[model samples]
Structure formats: C-alpha cells, structure tokens
Target: MNVMIFLLLSIICIGLIFIIHKYFGKEELYFLAIIYAIVALMMSFKTIKIFGIDINASIIFDSGIIFILYYFIRKYKYNESKKLMLSILICMLITSMFLITTSIMIPSLYDEFNFSYQNMVLDNLPTIIIYPLSLLITMSLSSYCFRQLKEEEDYRLIKTILTIIGITFIEVLIFIYFSYAFMIGFKKALIISLNSYLAKVILMIIFTIFLNIIFKVKKVKE
Candidate 1:
C-alpha cells in the first residue's frame, strides 16, 4: 500500500514536470521545484515502512526536485539549473525560519493543534537544518554531473541512472549521518539510510525512464 502510494506520487510529480514545461514555461518549473523542496523538508519528519524497511517519506519529492534540476540542465542551460538550485535553497531557508519562529511562539488557548505542530518542528530542527545543506551539496554534484554528461546523446539514460544512484546515495548518507546518527545511534541510522537509499534509487530510476520518454516524445513532436 505504501509502495503503491509512493509510485503514484512519483508518477504524478513527473507528469507535472512535463506538463509545466510544455504549457507553462521554465518559470513554472522553478515554482514547482521550490514547492517540492518545501514539501520535502516538511515530509522529512515523517517515516513510513515500505517492504518492511523504514524510510523517510520525503524521497518522492526529493527525487522530483532532482528531476526538475536535470530537466533544466538538459533543456535550458547549466547556469539556469544552478539558479533553480539557489532558488530552492533560498525558499527552504525561509521555510526553516518560519518553522523555527512558529515553533517558539506561544499558542492561543483555542489552538488545539499548536502543541503537535510545535513538537514536530522542534523535534526535527536538526533535520530542518541538515536536510537543506545536504540537498545543496548533492544537488550541486548532481547538476555538475548531469552537465558533464548532457552532451552524450547515446548514453544519456545510462549516465542519468548512474548519476541518480550516486547522488541519492551521498544525500542519504549525509542527511542520515548528521540528523539521525546521534539521536538514533549510528547502527540504526546506518540501517535506515541504506533502506532509504534503496527506495530512492528505485524511484529515481523510474523517474529517469519516464523523463527520457517525455523528452523523446517532445523531440518527436518538435
């Protein structure tokens, strides 16, 4: 059930990427990337079991952000993807600030959900900080790699799959180490990170295939 939901969300996100690219413009893709980055940060606090292994629920959106970055790099310019990355970072920082401020605020007497919201944000403060930093590093790396390989038309799919695997692995390692290791113990954190990477790699591969198909179809239409 969780796996099904994960795939459904992945498909919807990938579909939206092409839809925005086709109808809207690069500006809309930037908007979508920022929205996904914010949602991914919020979802990092939640964990779900897939195939009986624990993983962050944010993987779907995170992969979407990467796909959008790759799309920018491939179709637009490398610098444009960097602009999108910086935009995402700025938006995420603003979001983190908002979460921090809201968490510290005293709630009104009638605010029933304030405690839960405050606790969730306070408890995951480390994650709020670390996740974006990890994202910045890994996304920089992913974009650099995609830029290097973008000119290779024959091996595009293979190179993209490999790049996603490498980027996702590093991202999981950095985020889980900084955010989860001390709190959950190194051993448990290692296990969860490995599980999370596996899930992310699978989802990324699926996104890569769909994205390639979209590009091909668009090329044919052009």
Candidate 2:
C-alpha cells in the first residue's frame, strides 16, 4: 500500500514536470523531470529506516541527477567533447555501482543505532544544508569549466545563467518534497517546502551573481 502510494505520487509529479516542460519549452528541464522520476521509482522500492522515519536512498541518487544536468549543460552550452562526456558517464556509473554494492552489503548497519527523533533530525540538518550547497558548487563548477572552453556572447551567457538558476530552483523543490513529504504531515511539509525554496532561491541569486561576474570577466578578456 505504501509502495503504491509512492508510485502514484511519483507519476503525478512527473506528469506535472512534463507539463511545465511543455509550457516552458526547456528541453533540459524535461530531462531533469525524467531523471527525478527515475530516482523516485527507486525510492518506492527501498528506503532506509532512521529513527523510525523512512528515508529514501534515492536522495543520494538525486545528487547524481544534478551532476548529470551539469554534463548536459556542458554538452549543449560548450559543445563538450564526446570523450570527456564518456569519461563522466563512466565515473558516474562506477560511483553508482559502488553505492549499490555498499547498500546491499550493509543494509542493516544503521538499524543498530538507536536514534531519538530530535537527535536524528538534528543530525540530518547538516545534510539538508550541505545538499543544496553541494548543488550550487556543482552548478558553479560546470559553468566555470564550460566558460573556460567557450564563452558565449553576453546575451547567450545571460540566458544560460538564467536557465541554470531556474533549473536549480526546480531541483531544490523536488529534493525537499521528496525528502520531507513522506516524513511529515501536510502542514509541516508545507512549511519545510517554503523554507527550502527560500533557502535555494537565495543560493541561486548569489550564484547567479557570481556567474554574471565571471561572464563580465570573460567579456573583458575577449
């Protein structure tokens, strides 16, 4: 019954994303939605029980999705070479394999750790902050690398940066929704959802400014 509800929720979210993609005409976001759906499906099948709260392993996998998006942006915006793309793909594959192996080998490792709800939530607070920060770093790194190889015209650069910001915004919402919706009731989930969006939006604004500065430097160079 739980699995069925999860699957249904996944389908509904994916459908909404597709609709947004269609209306917004962002092919990259469409792909992002699809990747998110894949992660959600994986969560439906397996979850880690921490402090009697079920957390999806797929949250870790969501980080991989951000990396994948970085690759996509690199390829499209900078015409990243096939060899480098292949190398990235291989690295992601190997990392995923290692995670899967570790999960299988030590499924019950955390089960022995007694955790109070307050302690568990406190422990997870850092992760909640770290995940979004890591995502920002990924976006920044991807943009920096691509800009080193090829600098777009000023207008194109702005468009690219905006797209990255928009995608980051969506990514934050998706991550927060998946992480909390199952753990909290609707009211608390709504509060977390708002806070999460605000946090990520601030991060996005900061990063977007940083990107703009880099683009200005590139323009000055050219």
Candidate 3:
C-alpha cells in the first residue's frame, strides 16, 4: 500500500514474471504482471464512493486480470499442469496481497463509515463473502467468452480487448447484484448498479485499448 513498498513489490513481481517467461516460455504472464502492476499503481492513487460503500478503483481491474489468467490456462492447456497451476496460484496470491493491503489501509472518502474489510463485522460480512465469490463467478463466465475468442484468428486483438471489457462489465453487474443490492435494498441499488456498470464499461474499454496499443508497440519492437 505504501508507495515504497508497492514499488519494491512491483520490481519483485516484474522480475518473477521475467523468470517465468524465460523458464516456461510463456510471455503472456509477463503481460499479465504488467497489467496487474499498472492497475495496482493506478488504484493506489484513488478510491470511489459507490452504494454507500467506499471501494478501491483496483476492484475495476479484477475481471481483466481474471480474464488474462483464464485465457492463458485455456490457451496453454495448462489446466492439468501442476507447475502452471502453482505459478498461477502464486500470481493470484501476490495480487491478493496487494489488493488486501491497499484496500484495508487506504482511508476511503467515507472513512467515518465502517463497512469494508478493515472494519469487518456482521453488517459487512455478506459483502465480504460476495466479493470473492463474484470474482470466481466472473472468471467462470469469462472463460466461455475467452475460449471462443482464443480460437478466432480474425481481429483477435480487438476481440480480446472487447471480451475483457464485456466480462468486466459482467463483473460489475454481479458485484452489484450479490454485494451492493444486499448491502442496500434492491430499489436503491438499481440506479447505482446501472451507473456503476456504465462507468466500468467505459473505463475498461479505454484501459483495454491502451493496453492493446502497448502490446502492439511491444510486438513491433520484438
């Protein structure tokens, strides 16, 4: 969460990505690490108030990361590989540490309200439960889309970017339904859900496009 600590972790994560790429010949993990680190950095700088809950912006990056992991596991046929599974687990654990640390330590705009991870109580337990469940559900749903897109050769880059956005939007919806609506009643949650969905759709679209451009430039250099 601290800038110095985040920087140190970023260097270590990037180094690990290079090692994985070099040893296993999977460069996709490098890109994944880059996206994760970049998003983590961006998220450290801001928080948003949504549905009376203060959430970190890095939550927006969850589905994209999940999509990348799902894409690679399917692409490499690594579902049965223990080593690959271990590596993926390691990546997720590291990312979770970052997310947990940042989310717990950073004071949200509504710091006076005790409703998040740091102040976990009976009132917020359902939200905490739904958060990780929604992540798994989002990734599972995203797997179908990624599987379909991974096979197509035509406009694959564009397809991949769009898929990421679509899945992220789906995550927003799920988060709203399972988490937000339960926290607040359904009637009030509807409008907030719509606004959140649209906001995430636009943000992920722009983020995906920027990442696509970076990939293009990297490919050209290679």
Instruction: Tell me, by lDDT, which candidate is best.
Output: 1
Candidate 2 clashes: the total is 0
lDDT of each: 0.87, 0.44, 0.53
In model 1, what lDDT does residue 125 have? 78
TM values, all candidates: 0.94, 0.38, 0.55
Clashes of each: 0, 0, 0
Q: Which residue pairs does candidate 2 place in steric collision?
A: none
Q: Write the per-residue lDDT of candidate 3 for residues 120-175, one digit (tens) a residue.
A: 33344444455545655665666567678667889976787677767767766676
lDDT for 114 in candidate 3 is 38
Candidate with the larger TM-score of 2 and 3: 3
Candidate 3 ranges beyond 4 A from true positions:
1-58, 70-122, 217-222
Q: RMSD for each model, in Å, please?
A: 1.9, 15.3, 8.5
lDDT of 2 by residue, 21-84 (tens): 3453344443553455345334423434433344444433343344344434543444443333
Clashes of 1: 0
Local error of candidate 1 at residue 213 (angstroms): 0.7
